[model samples]
Target: MQSSFSPLVAISPIDGRYQKQVNELSGYFSEFGLIRYRVRVEIEYFILLAEKGIFKMPAKIKPAQLRAIYEEMSEADAQQIKETEKTTNHDVKAVEYFIKDQLHQLGGDEVAEWVHFGLTSQDVNNTAIPLLWKEAVEESFMPYLLNLIATVKEMARTWKKIPMLAKTHGQPASPTTLGKEIMVFVERLQNQIDLFGYVPYAAKFGGATGNFNAHQVTFPKHDWVAFGNEFVNERLGLQRMQFTTQIEHYDNLAAHFDTLKRINTILIDFCRDIWTYVSMEYFKQKTKKGEVGSSAMPHKVNPIDFENAEGNLGVANALYEHLSAKLPISRLQRDLTDSTVLRNIGVPMAHSFIALKSIEKGLGKLLLNETKINADLENNWAVVAEAIQTILRRVKFPQPYEALKDLTRGQEGITQKSLHKFIDGLDVADKIKNELKAISPQNYTGVEFDY
Candidate 1:
């Protein structure tokens, strides 16, 4: 808190070179952020207890005063909590004690003991983590993702009619529109992003061991399970995991991670394809004055942005995979592994944010080389063999596939003249020959898509 952080001295690139791009994530994923969320949960739980008549709130204790404890918590307050943690050696306990002190100062000392009543550290943690994660996704992550999707959508529509050769197994198989190729990723990404809505922002809120043992034993007439469900669902806007151990099952959280990993994987594929296009001169990147594309080669303009995006996306996916796999497992009732692992949730999110920004920038700099694309299609006249054979079959021609293969397969420089000659010599009528002659790589692309 007294200032030791500097970009030059930071260890991870997320906090160093790329910090400016993803700094907003600190509000939800930083150490101070974690403490603030914990304080929010503790204070909210206390207010809910008073509202339930679990304890009596004095007239002087206004709801605003209670909320202000967390809403207005400053760096100094978080630093104070860190100092307390240094002595207590328990982070959540530090937050609890900090709230108790706030309550005492507000002349509500009588109910200060109820600040974290009948709760274990996990009750505060499990709730706070999901609440912060939900906010981060909704407020921070989704906007960029939606904007990226929109940008891609607009690009797709812009290139909707542009035809390019389609490659399968690194060889030209047929022709597809550039827009449809881009839309493939767009559809895949949207499909996965939509799944986030179904994966609930889930939290575990029952007392220690998830039984609410202490709450029920103290108030035998009250249904503590119902209270937990309401507190987590109604109050926090998160789904409560009805059954869990000392920690939340994290199945929903893992689902979210898996979905995110898939989105990143799609983006990686997109980046690679775009990079290939740039290499093939299908895309010409815009150059800025005084910007060096390569130190050794002055004539080169590299696709560094797409390369950056691919690298960061790969890193993010690795972390997401680990998080999805590791978070759902713990030693019996609980383990400290998740505690440490969960703290790093923002690391992958930051990497992903950086990669998304890079991809957006890369896309902005792309200058579509329609000439190159059309030239590629024109050069690959052999690709139209598929269309010719398919049309011949429609006319009930004899062995149409084999005939077309003989003319195209293992043959170079199969120009339109040669194809026309082949069609003219066929045993079909002039109408059929004219129809076969009409087929060309440029016009042989499959049906147009409405999306």
Candidate 2:
């Protein structure tokens, strides 16, 4: 097919530079996605009403015929909705018309009036958007996040015992196993992922202004709240909010966005740490054939992957922050601000996906420099002072901390030989000297790799 780009190209990079990486999400967030979701909602609502006996459906909607209504909804069907939208200039109205046409084709013109029943554009939009978000999280976001976590966990296990010099304030402070450092991120991500799982995908389903005014006035006999709950929770797999205005209050959606921002923040932290490690020569990147790290510096194997991950994560978090903050506060009953803002939800998520991919790639390129790690530990002998002072305290030595502080603190080139020599000069017994002699920076990474 000959493709014609939209007359006005997208101003956002989600539809520009990084579109390919996040194309999979187009099925959940694009114009077509919106149409598909609307159709699903209309179909399901029809089915729900039939099951509830609110309207007498045909004697039998054969399984094949039922499937035909759902299965026949394709890209073409969505395009038809778009076509209708151009004339109506109202997106939800287009969907209602399209579904009514479909209902007419099925010889159910008598029931066509019940397609949207008594609902507002927000009702379809709120439920449909949440449904799409749910599917996107389940199929794309969660799997990718879980895979990233799994990879980090594997790295943690593989490098658990590999001791490296620990840095605080960008200076060597102590020793820590490489595995333990990785596990720190693993644990953090796992905790956030658990929270992400628990956050409910909520939707608003009452009529305009959230009071079910129209539905209640028309069908005063029916329990509309119960019906709304059942339709949203059971049929749509979303938690229904009983009270709302012209649109969903978006409190839960805001919470969901904030949660995503937290995850993105944690990833940004991890990317920076790994980038620093790479810069410190603790980790080396695997060179790919024909890939250039720098234009002029031929010898440069830059930490670009982590840099990219960090940059994209920053963008994602900024957008997430805006979405979380802006979506929840609509003027009085409602406003169009959220309508425009909500459309960009996928942009931040797409950037996040891009960042995730970059991190995954960066992780795959890592070649742990065991030699550099060991050399760093050997050179930073001053780190052993903690173990030495603690051991001295174990033997009830007077001013043990002060003694070690005087011996090692502010003393550069304080090697193993120097420490041992100092230990030997102590007034403490041979057993104490022997015990202190065994303490080394290499082994001072206390209990980090016991797992």
Candidate 3:
């Protein structure tokens, strides 16, 4: 039976309203995707066994033919496995049966018994889940994030010379370049992205209970430990966990979730900052034809993209927190909890992917309002007090901070004339007074960065 599930009827927004943005993720995290990965693991393990001479394969059976079982896996194949699961009441076992049925069709029934030999469900699951996750991160997630960072960097470079008032505790405090402010997020995101390398894409391939008891009892002479390592590390390109329970220990997996959560948190911060900038009119959005930002308000152009990104990032962070906290703690050796939780690994990923796309779109639409930015600088002359006071301090002037504070603090209508008047009254050299007059909010920004 074909899936009648359409986006219109889907429950989650990731699958419904935002499905188009995240459709590519289904290939990595969907039920069919999971089943396909299981098939791949089973076939590869069987081929490894054959290469090790653990079983005599028919001379006619080619490795390519075995590999095609998974490479050519279709929705029909996944559905057949699901049907088998109904009878077996076990998902991994259904995959094994499906592979055996394929081998039977290929005139290699003799080797079919060796498929998934001496392995429990965790052996396939622990390896497959992490392997697929590794692929998804490298292939999809990292690319999107890198692209977003590049966009941010480009914007930063463009506005590197643009001065804007800085706010601390929601009040104008100092002056900073727009580029430097944007670059802050770039450095923060890159720092966390680099940490991904430290947390390994770890997997467990040991047989039931973290030891190869079945393999050892059947063939005590074979080095099953080395076999497990080579299969998981070399063949699958995943870091093999040497010691584990029936399930993977999941500490490394938790680390991955935490790292992802931190990344999302940074994105959330970026979204809010961008939204605030939009509200401040430092940035204007390019209005689309026939698109309404607000139904009732005609002149409004809302920062919906950043708003969407923030909301999605919030949802993604919540899921990441649960996944990170829950996956590491299980009942003694193993339990069913990680199995269900592991399946949801893709849920937060899909949300994060959507948020990334939203952020990219939001960034692309930003039109820097240089007039507004400059006007803001011009209006907030009080910010220059810091520069004047700091220079006064450098000159060993008495009560520099107090003097500047008295002139600017809570005093309304402080303008160029008023500040210049105060500067002329200072008991300092003409050069010092001239220096103070030159320091406006626009030029009060600190040293230029190489951004």
- lDDT winner among the candidates? 1
| Clashes, model 1 | 0
TM-score of each predicted structure versus truth: 0.98, 0.96, 0.98
Q: RMSD in angstroms, all models?
A: 1.2, 2.0, 1.3
Q: Give the alpha-carbon lDDT of every model.
A: 0.92, 0.86, 0.91
Candidate 1: tens digits of C-alpha lDDT, residues 315-428: 998999999999999999999999999999999999999999999999999999999999888888889888888888888889999998988998999888888888888887
* lDDT tens digits by residue: candidate 2, 62-110: 4356446555667777788889999999999998898788767777788
lDDT of 3 by residue, 1-451 (tens): 2366898988998889998898888888999988988888888899899889899999898999999988988888999999999999999999999999988888998888899999999999998999899999999999989988998999899999999989999988799999999999999999999998788999988899989999999999999999999899988999899889898888998999999999999999999999999999999999999999899999999999999989999999999999999998989888798888899999999999999999999988999999998887778888889888899998899999999889999887888888899899999999999989988888888889896
Off by over 4 Å in 2: 1-11, 60-72, 448-451
> Model 3: runs farther than 4 Å from truth?
1-4
Residue pairs in collision within model 1: none
TM-score of 3: 0.98
Candidate 3 C-alpha error for residue 17, in Å: 1.5
